[model samples]
Target: MSHDENNAVLFGSGDEAPSNHSHNPHFNELVDARRRQILAGGAALGVLGFLGVGLPGESQAGERHLPPFGRRNRLPFTAVAVGRADGISVPAGYRATPFIPWGTPITGGYPAFLEDASNSAQDQAEQIGMHHDGMHFFPIDAQYGAGLNSRHGLLVLNHEYIDAPLLHPNGPTVVDGKRVSAEQVRKEINAHGVSVVEIRRDVRGEWQVQPSARNRRITAATPMQMSGPARGHALLRTRYSPEGTASRGTQNNCASGFTPWGTYVTCEENWAGYFASRDSDLPRELKRYGLRSSSRFGWDTLSGDEFERFDATRKGADARADYRNEPNHFGWIVEIDPFDPDSVPVKRSALGRFAHEGLVFAKPRAGKPVVCYSGDDAQNEYIYKYVSRGKYRPGRSDGRLLDDGVLYAARFNADGSGDWLALDLQDAAFQQACAAAGVSFADQGEVLINTRLAADIAGATKMDRPEWGAVHPDSNEVYFTLTNNSARTTADAANPRVKNAYGHIIRWREERRDNSGVRFAWDLFLLAGPESDSRGPNGQALGADNMLASPDGLWFDEDGRLWIQTDMSGSQLASGPFGNNQMLVADPHTGDMKRFLVGPLGAEITGITATPDFRTLFINVQHPGEGSTANNLLSTWPDGPGKRPRSATVIITREDRKRLL
Candidate 1:
């Protein structure tokens, strides 16, 4: 089946009152007229209210009644706020039930997690990983057999980072500013990567963790094979993988995607900043990829082969014999066949490089090519897509179908139309550009490994920290979050603002076509800011209710409900009047946005997913009061009082079984 069969369009022209035009002149005029009409109608309503005959809730004589777009309902259920010891607050109607917390046994064979527990790398894999982010649920069919619904399916989640202090029995001690133990380093390494746990609902409708045939954990030490255009490039070669065909582990798996064929696509984000590198010791090419001279976490100063090897800066005599391949292993989309417990994950090089935030696939058409969109997850990086050259075969659920594709980086133009620039090594321009950049590649393989260089040569627009993205169900329009960029980066035509602290959501529709088309029209949907900031020609504010800074996680539900979650630094959280970070729901058509839930103090509201029934929603509350040290705990959320803040996934459902949207 094609994507259109399962996806529904959420917004149409009727939903948008277009006055603020994007680069598209035609759309600008069309939207402007609608905005004027909306304003005029609003004014008429105000006048009628003054006369007292036609009140706010009442309609004029013979006029039809409009639905309540912004008014609050006496919702049958109330939202219960969940917090830790420091008192993390949530919305009033919802209660949070911890589904998976740090160190929970994932595989069922392990001993229960103890707060100060120290497990070997192998044992840790059987246990839940650290910092759970994006997660999703797959329901099992009864046809698969009894206990199937209760023990089948997978819960794939990302392990963003490790909490060093809590992971060890004692705090990670830096003796002379360098860690002294190899065991400490080993624990940290095991903490990063993705976890897949089997879960099921019992007769009572309560979900339970199960140790099943499909329960597994993939960590930073798991072996992964490279596929597609850049498979065996020289840049991927290291002592670990002499042929450049394989790499060890995946880190920073953030917001993710699942294939129509039922596989999981986990993204590698913020992977660059983890490696320790010094200016003098690193190669010029490596530095360009954001591995500047200094290490952000100071992990390299620690002892042990694992901790020291995490630093990409060279210390050995030969590049091929040392840690050179470490950088190459990361920054790619790692695909996992979740149903096949024994299958190895494959990193498709055809997708290109950079800090990937998430990947979303379009519904594949029978005769048309398959299209997938992704973000670079960094300030001033570019957006990209991979279009398969071969047509998608419907109902073909095999894994190998995703192996081949033509990668293209987007160039969104000011005129409202955009082009997808191909990054094919066979192209003459690409060959010439590669030669000029002092990079040698025999085929598309090398180009995929050095995708940033290729996009630079192609002149793709640099966006402000592009993060998570989702394609609208109905319109086939693509939307991506440009999470906040600090004052340091330069702003160009594509990114026209300076010091864009409060990020924005930009979206655009294809011109008379779907994802397979080479060209499309575009527009900026909403500029996120605080209410006190500024308003567009339409009454939409750049602030609080409407203004959300650092829009990270976004997903469109089966019912076409757009859910947005935010992630703000601690400094921004305390001073802003918006209270704390929150999740907002918006109707794309009417531009009706409302705050649904707020996170705890010093915590970021990340990763969100909804069940097909739209009855249960799962959200991750990550690192509450993150900046607090061992001696000082700012927010005791999820675990009030003596407990340290634990990153966890909260499951929410209406007690009455009503539709959440």
Candidate 2:
């Protein structure tokens, strides 16, 4: 999420006042305690010999090798220089083509994009939404070629949030500080969900949207189902779903993941800002997520039940009679089957959500319990993992497996070791810890509902705003990006820097390399910052070729290369050592890193994926011209001069049409 003035309120993770005030042990204290114990011969090994600088057994020699592109583990392309440009920059032999901008028609009467931003709310439902984020490619040829044929597939991506001024012709209509135009508010709501569009490569080797039945848009008004342990709970009961078995829509989706069963899971991030409550005594669920008197967008200021649902206040006699429970219906990982156009999205509540940044499943093995990780992208939040109760079967698995699982919050201990504290109500340790903290759960449903509070009681480590997570394709080691937390005044083993302006990446390996294990060994992969503050895997300061900050989006390609993307704030780009938000790929094994691309001014380079054959790469440039309003624009990207700036996805490939490393 961008930190421009306009986005500061929308992406409230960093700007908003933190709700967590837990008195958990600081990470630096834990590291000091572990070091003392090791030196006193009380411990067997010294995992934090030098504050867990790098992974154990890392090769110091050949760590800085810059061989030309030949081996799969080496970075192939020349590093792109850092600068603040008005467009994208790639290597010499690579071609970057802008594919789908904010408003391109794919379904529903095939409405064309209006240059004047006069498209109606109904038109937005039929067109692409704003601010494209996390995405994946589901090939249509999966049944035949192991889904490697990505030339023609469904390009499913998330629309994080809407730029209100750009969504309307002359900006939004307001009366006495409240939004008056119902259509404008409705259009913004429609642009806050997911887009599943059918895209195929043309004979000219250009990707284009195809008009197919599978090209569907699931927006804020789409009907969905509620599943998992918390489904039909009292906290989820609302007027729209009296039985509490369903929900309205998904919003503020940032990063996403796909299941082995061929389903897509979109994560809800910074969604609490969309809801408002005037009541002083708010429920813990709403209060913990930071719902306040006025919403960032005044959707509830309009006059209808549909718009009034955004006001999550207690007005009616009971929970089912009002929209007080509407906020609870959100914050969960929504599972959608793109292949089945008519399938209703299910909110898998067993995953235990709290401002979910993204969900990444570990490498799956048949007859093993399916495991996945999610970060609660907020200051001083905890990381969570879910392990299925039943073992996964390759061809027979589905979202039902997510309905029954053990959700655990991570507790990164001293000595570079960690434990997965189970949130289960029946677990003896969990029960005793809750009892000690004067916290008790009625059942598993309540435990999952108050996930953040439960994590605090479980003594989970306070992290520096955990965000997107990825699992190594071969080693199954999980890596998470702890984006910058400027509010931190104390250091800990997991978060070493106080007042951490630039973020860092943390990686861990489960016991015996088992994703379902309760213990793990962890280390700091990269301390992201300028050349002076940042440290690479070789325990050295980063060079000009790989300087970065606020590492947000992350992924491990099939070849085990770690692709890192940055989401630095607008102010950071103006005064920091790094010029623009960029993307870099690194060999986790050797610590060699290279800058691959740099985005335009005020744009965040996020949401990256590639064809299975490794020939093409797809990435999203969000909020180009970060602080742009209707009158004062900062950028006109993808489309040249005289055109309004629109966020879009860029498609890149090798010049010789060979595989892209």
RMSD of each: 11.0, 4.7
Per-residue lDDT for 1-661 in model 1, tens only? 2222211111011110111111222111222323333234223211121111221221222132223435443222233222222443445455457777777787746657765455665567778788888776655552233312323456788888776656665556454445556666666777788877777667766767886777777887788999876677777777677778887888878888877666788898777766656637555346556664434445666755556656676667665766755787788998987766788999988887778889888766676777889988765677898887777776654445566777887776544456777788766766776677676756677667777767877657666677888876765667788877774344332233456777767665553344765566555555566665433213355434445667888888764456788887755676755557777766554455666677777777888876666677788888776755455667666667756667778877665655565
Q: Which portions of model 2 show Cα errors greater than 4 Å? A: 1-16, 33-73, 143-145, 491-496
Q: Alpha-carbon error at 607 in model 1, in Å?
A: 1.3
* lDDT (C-alpha, whole model) for all candidates: 0.65, 0.83
Residues 117-140 of candidate 2 have per-residue lDDT tens digits of: 999988998899999999998888
Candidate 2, after superposition: displacement of residue 36 in Å? 11
Query: Which residue pairs in candidate 2 collide?
Result: 27-492, 27-493, 28-491, 28-492, 28-493
Which regions of candidate 1 are displaced past 4 Å? 1-93, 117-123, 141-152, 277-281, 293-308, 313-318, 397-399, 428-440, 488-498, 534-539, 542-547
TM-score per model over all chains: 0.82, 0.93
